[model samples]
Target: MRIRRAGADDAGALALAGAATFLETFAGILHGRDIVEHCRKQHAPQVYADWLDDAGAALWLAETAEGAAPVGYAVIAPPKLPLHDLSEDDLELKRIYLLSRFHGGGVGRELMEQAVAEARVRGARRLLLGVYAGNTRALAFYARNGFEHVGERRFQVGGNTYGDAILALDLRR
Candidate 1:
C-alpha cells in the first residue's frame, strides 16, 4: 500500500470513509443512534476539509494500489480536550480508522507509523491518545504497538458514562 498526505480535495472521501469505518467498528459497542450522531458530527465534510486545510495538522491516507483510492486515514494534531492532562506540546492522535475490509491487513499499522514519524519530525517527544474502555480490541492494539496507559477520564455518551483510558508512547526513548 502507498501512504501519502491528504489534501482538502480528499475531504469528502475521508468523511465517507470515517463514517463507514466508525459504523463498522462500533456497530454493537455504541448505540446505533449515538454512533450515527457521532459520525454525523465528527465526519462532516466541512470539518474534514477544514482539518485538511489546517497547517498545524497532518492527515495521511493509505491506498491499496498505485493511483487507487484511499482505504484508511489518520489525523494528528497538538493535544486538545477532553485531554487536559497532556501538555500543550504533546502530539495527539485524534483519529485513526481503516475500512473494515482492510483491518488486519497492515494498513492501520502503516498509518500509525506514519503519524508517529510525523510527530517525531515535528519535534514531539511523546504521542498521546485516548481509547474508550469499551474498545478492548483497540486498547490491545495500542498497547501492542508500544503505548502505555498513563491516565483515565470519563466520557458520557448516549447518557452513559464510559471510561476513556489515556495512553502515551514516549518517542524520545
Candidate 2:
C-alpha cells in the first residue's frame, strides 16, 4: 500500500473510498436509507473538492501497489467538534476509513500517524475526532493510539441522530 497527500484531482477516488468504506462499516448498524443518504451527501466528490480547496485542511489517500486502486483515506481539518475550548490551535480528524480487507494490515495506523504529523506540522496542539459509540473496534483503535474520550456528541446520519464519543489526542506529546 502507498499513502500520499491527496490533491484536488483525487476527489473522485476519495469519494468512492469514503462511500464504500462507510457502507461496509455501517451497513448493519445503521438504517439502510440513512447510510445511503449520508454517503450521498457526505462522500460526494464536490464536498471533498471543497475541502481540498481549504488551506487549513489536509487529506491523504491510500492505494494498492498493483493498480493504484484507492482503498482508504484520511482527512484533517479545522476543529468542528462540540468542544468549548476549541480554537485555531486544534484540528479535527474529520474522516478516516479503510476497506475491511485492509483492517489488520496497519494501514489505518499509518493513516492516523500521517494525520498526527500533519496536525503537528500545522502547529496544532490537539487532534479531535468523533466516532460512533457502538463501534468497539474503532474505539479500541483510537485508545491504542492514545486518544481519550473527552466528550459526547449527537451525530446525524440522514434522518437519524445517534450518540457518538468525541475523542482527543494531545499532540504536544
Candidate 3:
C-alpha cells in the first residue's frame, strides 16, 4: 500500500472512504439510521474540506497496491475540544479508518506510524485518541502502539451514547 498527504482535492474521496469504512466497521454495533446519521455529520465532504483548509490539520490517505480508491486514512491536528487542560504541544489523532480487507495487513499500522511521526514533527509532546470502549480490537491496537488509557469520555453518535476510552502516547518516550 502507498500513503500520501491529502489536499483539498481529496475531500470527496476521503469522505466516501471515511463513510464506507465507518459503516462497514460499525454495522454490527450501530443499528439502522444511527450509522447513516452519524456518518452524514462526521464524514461529510465539507467537513474534510474545511479541515484541509486549516493550517493546523494534517490528513493522510492509504491506497492499495492496485492504486484505486483509498482504503484507509488518518488525521492529526490540535484538539477541537481538549479532553482536559492540554498544553500547546498536544495533538489529537482525530480519526483513522480502514476497510475491513486491509485490517491485519499492516495498513492500520502504517497509518499510525505516519500519524505519530507527523505529530512529533509538529512538535507535539503527546498524541491522544479516543476509541470506542467496547471495541476490543481498536483498544488492543492502540495498546500495541504504546498508548495507555488516560481517561474516558462520552461519545454521542446520533441519539446514542457510547463510552470512549481516551488513550495517550508520550512522543518523548
Give the winner by lDDT.
2
What is the lDDT of every predicted structure here?
Answer: 0.83, 0.96, 0.89
lDDT digits (tens) for residues 86-150 of candidate 3: 77889999999999888998889999999999998999999998888988988989999999998
lDDT of 2 at 83: 84
Model 3, poorest ten-residue lDDT window?
79-88
What would you estimate as the lDDT of candidate 2? Answer: 0.96
Q: Backbone clashes per model, in order?
A: 0, 0, 0
- What TM-score, to 2 decimals, does candidate 2 have? 0.98
Comparison by lDDT, 1 against 2, better one: 2
Better of 1 and 3 by TM-score: 3
In order of appearance, the predictions have TM-scores of 0.91, 0.98, 0.95
Off by over 4 Å in 2: none
Model 3 gets an lDDT of: 0.89
- Every model's Cα RMSD, please? 1.9, 0.6, 1.2
Estimate, for each residue in 140-164, the C-alpha lDDT of model 1 and write its tens digit. 8898889998888886555466688
